[model samples]
Target: MTASSSGALPQPRRFLRLLNFRDSLWLLAPIATLYGIFALIPFALIVRFAFADGGTHFATVLESRILVRVATNTVVISLMTTVVALVLGYILAAGLWRAGPKMQRVMLAFVMLPFWTAVLIKNFAWAALLQDNGLANTILQGLGLTNGPVTLLHNRLAVIIGMVHYVLPYAVFPIYSAMQAIDRKVERAARSLGAGTPSVIWFVILPLTLPGVYSAALLVFVVSVGFFITPVILGSPADMMIANLVNYYVRELVDFNAGAALALMILGAVVPLIVLQQSMGRGGRHGAH
Candidate 1:
């Protein structure tokens, strides 16, 4: 057809024609631009720094004596935090699952109250409560449990406490989701078959909740490893985790290369765990059929 006779399609029609999945890559431009500017570029620079000087910084970090100690501390604290959070989280999730509507609302609000609070604020609050002569010590002294103010803050225990408080919500959500997926009829049938409360929980509820607990454990432990402020606020120098290694290398030693190297190492470790979690999720998360 002649252009004059047929006329060109209108601009909107042409634009709409280009909007299909294969041709619509431009839709991602804005977010990709922002990510490049904000995330990828900075990360690339970190990689560059880490790989500079024949990649000696990696060796420097590895050879450093404190690396072993800091790594151990990080692993130990994260594991402890995961275990404690798992236990408490299971209780909370179970309560949430079984609660009446009004009580569930209250409990859910209590569970989610931490998300709105800043990490800095929460750590500092824990620091205040755990400090010498703070409320915890006052209560201890008042109850004659201590002859004097006990040292609650500036320890590994304090770090764990702060971390648990921060990460409790993460622990709860996955477990709660798993708990909600449980078939209540299973429990009812167990009871009808003469299974008592203990038997029902042991054979039915506990078995089903295991997947969520496992998910929450990995998630909480992964999060716990990256803790920085909590250790600084509630713990002594001895309690430094892996993240503190970056700060130590960069700020204390004035070694950005080593800091970048340490950061890359951390990224390497954490990314795999995250990938495993996501892969597991794709396989099916906390299903209880």
Candidate 2:
């Protein structure tokens, strides 16, 4: 081509470059719109409602006797759920890690079964099983373990059981992923050095999987904190959690401002946990390398 034509091409290229910036904005417009509508707007409204009447709503929430009890229950139940889920998940993950190919598939199915089931259905099923004269109670009585059908339903234990079942899969996957990353040769080397199976697992496997354990604990705890249905169905009124408290304020009392305040309180508690989880994840990745 001629030098004149080559020089002319630069002008069109510059124009295209200018148009690219506008094109990018157009591409991002939908995402920004969605975020504004769903996340930003809701957050703004929550803040407004929470701070209404010079922050009286927050003061009301904080001063309530029910709030104190609910908050305590939320913390206690979440901690219990986290501990139980971690222990059970670790055992299942260890088995999955050591299983043959066929057994691994079976174990995986068992781990994922809860995920496939709806939360409402699972909770309802547990309620039936744990109720007086239900299967569990009948078995206990028939086996001469109890005089009559023991009250298992509508208690803290039942709430914890339901929470643990739901969060178990969350715990298993993280621990199992960590297990998969471990080298089999490391175990063999430990055995060659006269380490017993328990010694090898305790000293080597457990330490290497700490990141996964930490991840699982935080995830399960976070999920358990937001529990509403399980606690309502399985636990008594006295066993209400933070989410239930929020529901009480909104639905029972018809206090939107107070409900928003309670919700913001939950958000305050959860945000730190989420931040900590993210930090641990990053640290784990770095340590792995």
Q: Which numbered prediction scores highest in TM-score against the true structure?
A: 1
Q: Model 1, residue 75: displacement in angstroms?
A: 0.2
Worst 10 residues of 2 by lDDT: 1-10
The TM-scores of all predictions, comma-separated, are 0.90, 0.89
Model 2, global lDDT: 0.90
Check candidate 1 and list the clashing pairs: none
Tens digit of lDDT per residue, candidate 2, span 1-289?
1244445565787757866756767677789989999999999999999998988999999899877888889999999999999999999999999999999999899899999999999999999999997999999999999998899999999999998999999999889988888989989999999999999999999998999899989989999999999999999998999999899999999999999998998998899999998788778843655
Per-residue lDDT over 1-289 for candidate 1, one digit per residue giving the tens place of the 0 to 100 score: 1244255557866645645533557667889889999999999999999999987999999999999999999999999999999999999999999999999999999999987899999988988888887899999999999998888999999999999998999999988987888778878999999999999989988877777777788899899999998899999999999999899999999999999999999989998888877676545544423
Model 1: lDDT equals 0.89
RMSD of 2: 5.7
260 in model 2: Cα distance from truth in Å?
Answer: 0.6
Measured by TM-score, how close is model 1 to the native structure?
A: 0.90
How does each model score on lDDT? 0.89, 0.90
- Each candidate: RMSD to true structure? 4.9, 5.7
| Top-lDDT structure, candidate number | 2
